[model samples]
Target chain A: MSVTLDQARKIIRQTMAKGEDMKLKPLSVVVLDAGGHVVAFERSDDASPGRFGIAHGKAYGAVMLGMAGTAQMKRAEDQAYFMAAVNGVFGGHVVPVPGGVLLRNAAGKVVGAVGVTGDSSDNDATAAMAGIEAAALVGEI
Target chain B: MSVTLDQARKIIRQTMAKGEDMKLKPLSVVVLDAGGHVVAFERSDDASPGRFGIAHGKAYGAVMLGMAGTAQMKRAEDQAYFMAAVNGVFGGHVVPVPGGVLLRNAAGKVVGAVGVTGDSSDNDATAAMAGIEAAALVGEI
Candidate 1:
């Protein structure tokens, strides 16, 4: 299944709402299609310049590797070279930390991914998961 | 036949040999499958580090745009601002210049591409074409 631009925007909006409800810090969010192409992205005014890349790279890496950010983080600890090669091949911007979650359709196929940054990785991941659930989709974080 | 590791290495070897026979500058080459994933890459000792990235990016751009290197170059001239946005959003390293040649199968399906650098764009394109031909593959140069 493919993610439409409207669906991507909805993900971003819901993600931001979750962040606000949790009283998290200023957040940056990015949504990507199955092909790892950006569909929509937004960052609060207080977010730093690096936030965009962090959020984008996180989602991109998740989509490309077919792994959630939390899964990647677990792998990163024992598989140093694997993560190194991943980042190296992908232009060194792949954030293998938490806060990136995959959106799965009812068939369990990965449709897209969402990434959030600017807060703790756990909180960011929580917000991303909530957004995906709120959008009437399943989360594979 | 499908593009395999053997095919990728053959493309790289032929591309480098063509550059050598033509007395071109130290050349770097990259072979990417249709998925835009790197299959193989090699650079001459004298080639700069950036050569690898240039060739990779050029080939990646061509694959993503579904255009040969020359085709992208022509488009770039007419769509300067469009390409500007492409490179800007794509981490600022997409090379729209010539030298990446798409490989087509007997059925006219794009199987992969080879990117060459370290010489003039035209000559690089020529070397890329030669490599594709030597591999018994047709190219959309």
Candidate 2:
């Protein structure tokens, strides 16, 4: 399942549009390819300056590890050494939270991921999912 | 001023090389384009996955706010509410610390920034600066 940059950009645009339509505060959105490279990104004008990277990092983490960011945080709860090692290794890219979602093709192959920030993790996840669905990509709850 | 993807990748590679030469532990490096969007990034295989996000966040915060992450940390002390607001707005992307450096062009225009983690904040800053220098870009110390 190859994810195109155009699709990623479309997801981001639609997501941002929904956020605006809902009057959600400024948000940051990111899309990653299957290989974990960034495909597209944006930080809303109202979004805090660094929100873009946070969103991207979380999304990148989810895709690379093949798990939710929140799951990683859960794992960190009982494993300081693991957490520290993660901190040491990834240079801080893996953010364990619930704001990211994996994208799958119709064949159920993981194609990419989307991450959103500037809201609760749940809300961020919701927005990302909405975007993915709008793009006709399969996303898991 | 624009920071090219090639320059960003170069920064990460050189920074990682310096870390290896100095016998530092595995490192994660991130480069942010103007407006604080990630332009390019690479995570060492041995580096912890979390380092990727943390490094990017810290660096994004530094450049987005036009100050060193450490300086922001210092200011946050007196402006807890503002800092909290930043955190909320950024959705966990901002890390006020010393591990990131702002990148500038010849005209003193901030074109991008670099962030490194997996060691002391000072060490991270050193690596980030080295990468910036290697790119022939001026770094705001």
Candidate 3:
């Protein structure tokens, strides 16, 4: 599956707008290709500078690991050893947070991921999900 | 400027070893290329899974923007608009945290970056610097 630049841009715009409507503070959003390379990113003016990195990592981790950072975090609680081994193997690029939403095609194959930061983790996840749905895509596991 | 997979792996190994000697909890480390692409990553067995993404984003943002995410956070205090514009433009992958260390050559050209998480930002930065220096590379601004 492929994610177009246009689609990524649209996701950013729509997500930002949703953030505005929610009266959330500044935000950072990122979209990644299936290969986990960045396709696009945006940071709101009021967002903390660190928000961008956090958001990007969340998104990239989702794409690379095929799960949300939140979910990964939960699993880490029980499988600390495995998580540590994977982290060492991957060099710490995979995060399991809710803020990351996987993009899936109609056939349900993972295509890409969207990640957001700069608000509560829940809000960030919500915004990313909004963007993915806005792009006419589904957010899967 | 480039950070090869071998150098990145070495950095992670050295950093982890140091962490172990110090009896520090598990850590997550990431190396990024000049283009902010992941070259290598690792998560210590005891580290949180989320640290992986956080570390990767921090490192990528440092390399992409030529500064630490913590410094970027400081800049955001005064330049909210500029920061926001950047967030919008980059789609949220830029972080200005202290854990990010830019890799440079003697010629002072940025080659890549290293980011560490699962510890204080300051400790993460320190470990990253040690790794860079161990690789016989320069880390700066």
lDDT (C-alpha, whole model) for all candidates:
0.79, 0.76, 0.73
Docking quality tier of candidate 2?
A: incorrect
In order of lDDT, best first, we have 1, 2, 3
Residues B13-130 of candidate 1 have per-residue lDDT tens digits of: 8888989999998888898888888889998875533466678877877777788888777766676667656765666556776888888888888888788887877899888888
Comparison by DockQ, 1 against 3, better one: 3
Candidate 1, residue B104: CA error in Å?
28
Residue-level lDDT tens digits of model 2 in B1-141: 667766875787799888888788878777887887766555665565466678888888877788877788787898878877887888878888887788889898888778888888888888778888889998764
True contacts kept of 1: 0.00
Top model by TM-score, which number?
A: 2
* Candidate 1 local lDDT, A40-114, one digit each (tens): 999998888889999997887788666788888986785443355345446776789898888788887778889
- Model 3's number of clashes is 37
Task: Provide the lDDT at A43 for model 1.
Answer: 95
- DockQ by candidate, in order: 0.03, 0.07, 0.03
lDDT of 3 by residue, A19-67 (tens): 8888776778888999988999988754534465667667776777788
Q: Give the residue spans of candidate 1 off by over 4 A.
A: B1-141
**Candidate number of the best lDDT:** 1
Cα misplacement distance, residue A110 of candidate 1 (Å): 1.2
TM-score of each: 0.52, 0.54, 0.50
- Best by the DockQ measure: 2
